[model samples]
Target: MKGKWHSSWLLLLIAVVLVLSACSSGNNSSSSADNKEEATSSGEPQDGGELKVGLSANPKTLDPILYTGVYESQIMRQVADTLVVYNKELSDFIPSLAKEWKVSEDMKVYTFTLRDDVYFQPGEYQDGRQMTAEDVKYSLERSAKESAMNRLRGVEKVEVTGEFEVEVHIGTPNAALLAMLTDSGNIIVPKEEVEGWGDQFGSHLVGTGPFQIKDWQKDSEVKLTRHDKYWGEKPHLDGVSFKIISDPNMMTNALRSGDLDVGTDIKGQNRELIKTDQNLELLSKPALSLTYLDLNNKKGPTADPKVREAIYKATNVEEIVKGVNQWGGAEPSFMGLPKQSWGYSKDLEKLKPTFDPEAAKKLLAEAGYPDGFKTELYLSEARVPYGTIFQNQMKENLNVDVELKVVEWGTYSDTVAKGNAPMSIGGWTWYPDPYFFLYQLFHTDQIGALGNGKGYSNPEVDSLLERAVSETVDQNERAKLYQQALEIILKDVPRIELDNLEASAGINKKVQGYDVSSDFSIIIVSPNGTNVWMKQ
Candidate 1:
């Protein structure tokens, strides 16, 4: 593990001057618009400073295109710029690298005008590698084959229109295209560095953002200095140092001891202890996190629908919301999708797995597990602050003996999402769209290694989600489509819908400029950590 290495922003990093074309100059929004930039509600403008962000788990890779989870994606968001960026608050999509774009009348082929000012950071590739229309083409084209982005390969064609523009001809009019662009994903990398980086690309990521990589030590720390060629507002902090320490208890202790400035996943399955700490401030709210227990159906003891029902009926989401998370922190849900997700049905929660022992035992008996079968529950540590809570609850409700397989983040992601493990535990951080959740978990035909253990197959559900995107219409119609999709998911029971956990952050009250929002979660700090300054 790499010990912490710190560098002052003012002294250690190059200050990037991102000169914007005048508002009328066909570039991004003007400097004034940039000033209005904020990370989320209560967040302020980008300033010069250094932020010490402590990560609970090490990053799989720094490559935005490859890393598929949380802080890793968020960190890449800071260091890269995509064609389209979600507004600082993630309320809407605004142009970033692509200066402007026009939707086709059919909405199937959207054309974008690239910005000439955008340039790749100087690296092994020669200096002044101006970002070209071809770079956009190559980047998106490469993403098609990317292991983490194979779902995106469905794209039909990417044509460079002109020196300043390109055209994306989709296989269909995907409503989720814009939403996907808003993901920390689709972050454009310099086409030059990608082909040769191999497995190292995730770690040696370089982008045209306000930040540039200084160094990264596996399972330890990653340091990013500022990128002066960046075309957007600069970061206030001189540099950012992210330290990876797995033990949640050690994480909280470090924050309380003032050894770390900020930490993620600061809870230890104990809310009261976190609430009483005076030295540290805990910042938490309804986050996009939703957990589940997946039953592998392709080849496993859980393949039987009766077994799936037995597990679901034995689960009580409401009991968990109270016994485990008491800070109004979670809602018992059989809602396959996140509560705030589009097409979330209040009625569906009732249809979703509920606390029905009778129904469960009946199914268990039919499945020949009259005396519930014992199985191992695989838990991903990168998920919630605690895995034992869900495991404990399972053992309590079903009277089924469960052995725990608590795995680290990287392998766990692949195991659960890629069908490597049966009856695995996982969570999805939803935002941009239901596709982020649905596209990953379902869609049996696409992306070979991905999908939550369950070989969930349903023509109706797949068609619904596919049509939801392929067809252009009002929001209400699309939502109805998703609800129908959820109906299929609920019935198939590939995963036992767990509760939607209300995300809370452990913030030191002293750290200023913490933007609190259920959608976006990035925060900034002042030089002294006394005042939380912002734009409006």
Candidate 2:
């Protein structure tokens, strides 16, 4: 009887083990099925869709070297690739066409190694060909010789050292060269296409980039198709089309109706409208751009330093900025450099002129204008708001009579460029480097269309700016020189600093990984676009 009972107990233990194994297997199967379902529902990058983008203005040209406006760069950048790409902050660089590069100890010579895999997109002028050092040398030399912007003026020559290596020699040590190379003008172009197309090259563009120009219908739209043989991680979108919608309201409406995937330059109430909409998102990044009032330093009432100082003291910049950017797209600025700049000095904020109408009256009286004189504030249509606010402030604070002269953009820009406007509203947009802002806009040597339209000339300021560019690779030291220059410039009052603008875009929820560059550049298909994808 005892033996029989022990045998039965052993059989019962075996049966229990079998049942537990069966249940564990079933649970494991269920968990695996649930995980697969979750992944399918999650948002992931979908491939093979065309992205439609809306542009506020038509691009002037597609040629990288000859184009002067940001609108052109917006389209050219999609078709061309720069040697090195800078971050939105302009703090660092990443290799693009050139896989690697080295700067000499003296900082004059920049040697680059071309990436072996990059190939120019095929076009009407030539079949797609591998990009070599020859292409780099040709592109750089051509830009240095013929670029309208003179972006590569510092580059003396580009020499092809080997089949895949080249050297860019400059006459002087320039701290801004690396940052300058990131400009659209420096993108490598195929020699065959450029020579073949000649003067018509702007219409027939070719380059080594993720996208190839398919068609440009002037004021209608610019179409681009993906280059399947792109050297880098391929663009997820099959193509991109830039629809020219000159009116901001129409652009916003198109985005709302799902006719566009992205809308550039969304401003004012449009920004708020996008914010409230569940299907849209507003992407805004503080831009490296400024809108300021230029006080003519050559010949005018404003030429008097006392008068300029009085105007700076009388005007309330914060209130003006708030009024101009009523829908919230700008911040009041104190210095020439925008607050987003890496070299911008927080300490300089302490030096901003305090608004004191009483002190302004005293300065005006000392300058022989106790009763402020009437002057014309020249501006374009877009800047009428700034002009109105400033005109009102002068009248209210200094008992000054002001006239607002609103003209066409071309006339307004030409007047300011020639230093003809006694007081003009001018805007500048560039990289985050202080040299780009200070040297061009404040240096005496650049007293024309180059940028110094106010005729500002100070030998001490020029010396500081020159030293900042040639003295050191240490950015901290360069920043110190810039800071000293800013202090003197602030006191001189060449221009009344008003506000820094922000680049804002309206994007649909279907578009993923879209980024707004502070320099107002659009890079939707490159690495800078951050693996941008769209949902089906």
Q: Which candidate achieves the best lDDT against the true structure?
A: 2
TM-score on alpha carbons, each prediction: 0.72, 0.90
- Quote model 1's TM-score: 0.72
Model 2, 288-376: lDDT tens digits are 99999998999878889999999999999989998878789899888899887778999998887889989999999999998779888
How many residue pairs clash in each candidate at the backbone level? 16, 0
For this target, which candidate reaches the highest TM-score against the unseen true structure?
A: 2
Which lDDT tens digits does candidate 1 get at residues 96-142? 78878878877778788888888777766556478888888877766
